[model samples]
Target: MSDQIKVKLPDGSVKEVSKGTTALDIAKGISPRLADAALAAKVAPLPHNGDQPEARLVDLTRPLEEDSELKLLTDRDPEALEVYRHSSAHLLAAAVLDLFPETKLGHGPSTENGFFYDFYRQTPFTPEDLEKIEKRMQELVKEDVPYAREFLPREESLERFKTEGDFMKCHFIEQFTKPDEKISIYKTGKFLDFCRGPHIPSTGKIKAFKLLNIAGAYWLGDEKNPQLQRIYGTSFFSKKDMDEYFAKLEEAKKRDHRVLGKQLDLFSIQELAGPGLIFWHPKGGIIRKEMEDWMREEYLKRGYSLVVTPHVARTDLWKISGHTGYYKQNFFTPMELDDAEYMLKPMNCPGHVLIYRDQLRSYRDLPMRLGEMGTVYRYERSGVMHGLLRVRGFTQDDAHIFCTPSQIEDEISGCIDFAISVLHTYGFNEFKVELSEWDPNDRKSFIGTDEQWNLAQGSLKKVLDARGIPYKSMPGEAAFYGPKIDVKLVDAIGRLWQLSTVQFDFTLPQRFELEYVGEDGKRHQPLMVHRALYGSIERFFGVLIEHYAGAFPVWLSPVQTVLVPIGEKHLEYANKVGDVLKAKGIRVEVDGRNEKMNAKIREHALQKVPFILVVGDKEAEATSVNVRTRGKDKTETVPLDSFVERIEKLIAEKKPTLD
Candidate 1:
């Protein structure tokens, strides 16, 4: 066997080194500065038979025993930050063990923003205990203890953990490793963990980290298992970055939809009505009306026929649609009615399909677009019910199109165009698109033949490519029934929300046996496409609240104008002005209560009213008023007619800002 192996760098440079040399040695040979900044190394062994293996992250100390491609990851790489955060989680566990020796470790993994570690103990951890753990973590960092890795026989490792009262570790070992194989472990000081790790060299590498909070989680996510305490934390490469992150978090808290919803009296979730069910208040209902009206008008303009479907149907319908087999878990409990079982609809597709199949369609009536603002219900677990973003019941602006194979591309392109329009109308300018395709190797997980899958995916790609739109292709992320295109929008705080989707379902058409008479005088199956622009009305409303920070634009504000009378004598003129605005289709409210004008103005301003008009003797006699526009510091006096015209124009044009 050769004693030397070749290491290829990302820049296409290669170097021959001893087989036992480590990645850290290679980095040091390049430069001391590079070695100091390295956090982890990604290595891929050279292909043997024209097949390339995926590159994997490993410890810098891992020995390279074969010809490989190596890339040393530093602070600049996002993947390195993930590894750094995972190592920080281990440090957290070590600190916990130092303070409370009886704590049993579960698992620690990095999340999108930070890391979390689960621990099982009889006594719950207090805030004060967290503070002590954080301080001990600092001490460990000061000591710069090395993260040592070792492996042992699987049975021996499991027996050691079982004797030490670490049942969770034993469970993990038994579940993840074979009895005859070795198990990987990591040790820091006296703290040991059964982990498959590629951690940073030592605790000192974790410079900026904070323990955020703790929550209760069931073991393995089962309600019947013992509950464990999950502690959350975050780490960053630099202090400046950490500070910026916290600042953004503070802003996000201030803009939380739940807080703003109560302050503005928009929406609520009543405990008596049960969880995940929303009750839209009077103020919120006005906004919803506007949203629905706009969407319905667009449907008519786009040549779609509006339809309504029953909220509940027989279980036999779901069984035929295959929802009973794949999506039964998410369905609410079935109800027995008249010796037959019934269930609330979790989707609107089957109902629309039934309508299309009611009559034989011809080629001349090919593209039948059915649209509905249908409300559906699903059973969401108690722990997963978020504010409006996640709920048990919601309305979907769903539409389905049945067309010929030759016309499928145009239909998809049209759906994309409509989705873009929805984003623009809702004041969102930035968006991302993802095309999820099925996996050929996983035949059992996905439906449809190769020809159908290829045709559907190719049509979606052609539409996006022809329009010069950039998208990420995600293989193996498609639904069991078909492939789909998802559109996610970036909100005001730079958070992504899933807003729209256009999916291709060849399975449903076949399952329902939908057909149309073709131009060749033969019966052929119609292609089906399902699209939802505003994924859910409740979720979209929540996004709107956060995006505008409760200060809606002039077109969408519940109260477009509020008139405040300076004195009792001016009430008549205030009402006159309000009536005039109301006649022009503006949502106007007159503050005729016995109160000071400035106080009334301040109250309405707090409600985020778009326009506050103060009418007094001087302004009333001149037929003018003082206008205080939202988000503006200065007040301007303009004639009532001119103010009405300007606001009318703003509302008519659907402007995103008052100015």
Candidate 2:
């Protein structure tokens, strides 16, 4: 064994220290301030055979015996936040044990926004109990108890947990570790359990935390098992950050598409029709028509040939596409036909592939853009469905581009432009993109040869760089078939929604042996790109509802102009105005309900009519109207002809605002 080891810091400097020097010792050697700020350390040990070291989180106080590169993580680092939240979960479990000693603990892990722990107790935890548990948590934090990690023989650990009636912990230990191997456990104050943790130094580091709510969850997510109390909570580095998160949570609740869908009367999911299926009501149908028409027009303008495909195909077709072998889990059950078996198509790739291979094509037709508003049906777990976002059936604005290697980059660039236009035209200007690249180390998770993957990834990166578009690289997020680019749009209240995708599939083209004749009269396999601007019509509509809070722009509004007459005397003039709008292809309606003018205006406002034109006796005689735009308190009067011209321009431009 070496007496001294060289430890490399993030800044390329190395320190010759004793072999067992811990990360905390290194931090304190540098400065007490660095030691104080750090929550955990990410270390990559020097590999013995020249292989790259795998970076993993470790306790700051854990020993660094070998030559390793170390990074001390603080709140500023995104990874440290995850460890902080995980430690907060430990704090929550400690508090729960302190208040109710008999309750057994389950797994507590950090979620996307927060942390949750499942507990089994004979008595259900109530709102008041949550308050008490939170108070106890504060007390535990004040005590500054350390999260002490220990290793014990697996048999001994299981015996101890069994003595405490912690069957869940015992099960986890048996499932995750061999009986002969040592088991890792974490202890905080009097509470101790089985865990592998790189927790913060102590409970004191968990500064700001709130226990949000409680719900019931089955053990291991299996309903057949006993139910447990799942307590949800979130923690932040500062009180201000926590408060801002709560405020954002409130805003998200207000903008929930399910609630907005009801208020706008845009869509519904009926019980009779079963779950995970959408029912587009009349108003919603009109909005969908506008969306489809706009997309189809763009397809033609961009030189794409629109085509249609069937909803179902023979199971043999899916088998040929490798969908049955690779994607059978997402497929609906196969139906027994007289001649052969059939299945609902989960994707439009094979259908498009069949079209591409239907006729022999020369080099002049090398780049064929086949587009569709193709409806696909797939199986969705009953519990996972959430309104339009997760559905059993959906129409995709799906398109496939079959181009030669030289033309692949240009095709991707065109797809990106179309995707951006879709977002911008729908009123979302702020967006972030991600390129999902496969992990070369885990080659089993992805397909294609090294050269093919390199060429595809390089082309995508080149197009993004040429366009000067900013995107985050997400390694290992790529699909099994190939790499992809996902565009997530920021909504009105600052929620990110994933809508558009441009994916490269090297597997499907090869599976179908797709080819086009080259200039040399040789059959060459064409590179296939599958892109969906509006990934799914249903999901996009849901995002649109939440993005605009159901107050769609003039071009998307079902009833664009509503004529509200003040009295019966102005009813004739209101009808005439409606006639003019209808002739211009504007969606117009006259609200002649036997109600007060104010009542009519209030109703129309609730419906989110873009323009509510009030016609009274004087206004009708003068051929002018009072316009009350949605979200404004006051109404302005304008000449009828001028109003028509202004609205036509707004609709033509698809302005995000009436102004």
TM-score of each predicted structure versus truth? 0.93, 0.92
Lowest summed lDDT window (length 10), candidate 2? 319-328
Model 2 Cα displacement at 419 (Å)? 1.7
User: How do the residues 1-659 of candidate 1 rate in per-residue lDDT, one tens digit apiece?
Assistant: 89999999999999999998999999999999999999899999977799988789999999999999999999999989999999999999999999999999999999899999999999999999999999999999999988989999998998899988999999999999887888999999888999898999888888899999999989998889889999999999988889989998998898889999999999999999999999999999999999999999999999899999999999999999998888899999999999799999999999999999999999999799999999999999887898999999999999999999999999999999999999999899999999999999999889899999999999999999999999988989998888999999999988899989999999899999999999999999999999999999999999999999999888889999999988999999999999899999999999999977788888999999999999898899899999999989999999999999999999988999987
lDDT scores for all predictions? 0.94, 0.91
Candidate 1 collision pairs:
none
Which candidate wins on lDDT?
1
lDDT of 2 at 86: 91
| TM-score of decoy 1 | 0.93
lDDT of 2 at 503: 96
How large is the C-alpha RMSD of every model relative to the true structure? Answer: 2.6, 2.8
Residue 489 in model 2: shift from native, Å? Answer: 1.5
Model 1 RMSD in angstroms? 2.6
